[model samples]
Target: MSSDEVTDVIDPRPARRLDVPFQGFVVDMVSDEVDLGEAGGIVRREYVDHPGAVVVVALNEDGDVLLLRQYRHPVGAFLWEAPAGLLDLDGEDPHVAAARELAEEADMNAASWDVLLDLLPTPGGSNEAVRVYLARDLTPVPDDERHTREAEEADMVVVPVPLEEAAALALAGRLHNAATIAGVLAAAIGRASAWETLRPVDSPWEYRKN
Candidate 1:
């Protein structure tokens, strides 16, 4: 069968979904702890609530992927990551939000996009679902329309890195951001397969295989 005719069969298995009640946030706390049962059951759990977010993996016509290096206050250092942000509480769609974040952080707009995957960022603690999108057919736009926190805070610099290099970075322990690494590698593999299918051949691989 042709590559296009190939189908991925997925096993349908449901996870044990937990319904946890939200508690109030702490303005200040010295230490908070959770107690788990001896049998690996949760007796108590404490965590800060967070909303879902979207991560964009944008690729330009040259096949380079866009990335951002920004300072994370919590980490106290700069980290490479894809353009992403929390969803708008007013019920903004995740795909639209991903596109918006791409433009806001990278100053580029995608003509085509596909949602690669959605995953729970921290299943153990929080329920923040991060949706990853693969963006293509990129075009530059005005920087003034981009989102900004403060004049100096959260400076977003758009960097175009080759997809191969990005994947190498991830494997070499450079790309530490979970969402970004996952999204980039997914897109890279997809693009590679697409390129392979489109390559010119005498017999065409599909017929040869058959």
Candidate 2:
């Protein structure tokens, strides 16, 4: 095929009705039949219907990134991760969710924010889109105003790792959290480019919208 004819783009997904096989508290196992055009064919696919999420790569004046060591029951390990949360609240903006998670999980706030990266962590098995934000000019949340934690977050420990070191840890396969790895690497790239590639905090995210 000619280079001009080999362009990459998202073909319109075939219309399909989704049926829930198992509905859980926060997600559902959905099944659908998709038309893969003439060359391929129709195929049945099952995946987790996710509500999407946001991650905050909060950076201090020293360029160290805030991280939380939280116990993940599913993974059976404590992971060092950037402050993140699901977009479970009705009508909550992604940016607002990121800010809230930063304060709630990390006990901090950022004065500046920008879109660092967008990702589909498990495209083959889930439609879970994530938006990672670059948060700077950090300040601690007032003790009285701090959010009370529960469950997994109750014993979460806040830690600071330099952005460059975080990126290195990700490269070395030490950072296991998908969002944390992506966020720090993206932040490193953004910093190298003087953040010219960073998007506005309110940048349109069609993946989540759809």
Strongest candidate by TM-score: 2
What digit string (tens of lDDT, one per residue) describes model 2 on residues 3-99? 8898435566695867888999888899998998898799889999899999999999999999899999898999999999999877789999999
Query: How many residue pairs clash in model 1?
Result: 0
Candidate 2's displacement at residue 193, Å, is: 1.8
Clashing pairs in model 1, backbone N/Cα/C closer than 3 A: none
Displacement of residue 26 (Cα, Å) in model 2 is 1.0
List all candidate RMSDs to the true structure.
10.3, 2.1
Query: What tens digits encode model 1's per-residue C-alpha lDDT throughout 133-160?
Result: 8888888877666566554235656789
Q: Estimate each model's TM-score.
A: 0.70, 0.93
For model 2 the TM-score comes to 0.93
**Model 1 / residue 51 / CA error / Å:** 0.9
After superposition, the stretches of candidate 1 with alpha carbons farther than 4 Å from their true spots are 1-42, 143-154, 195-210
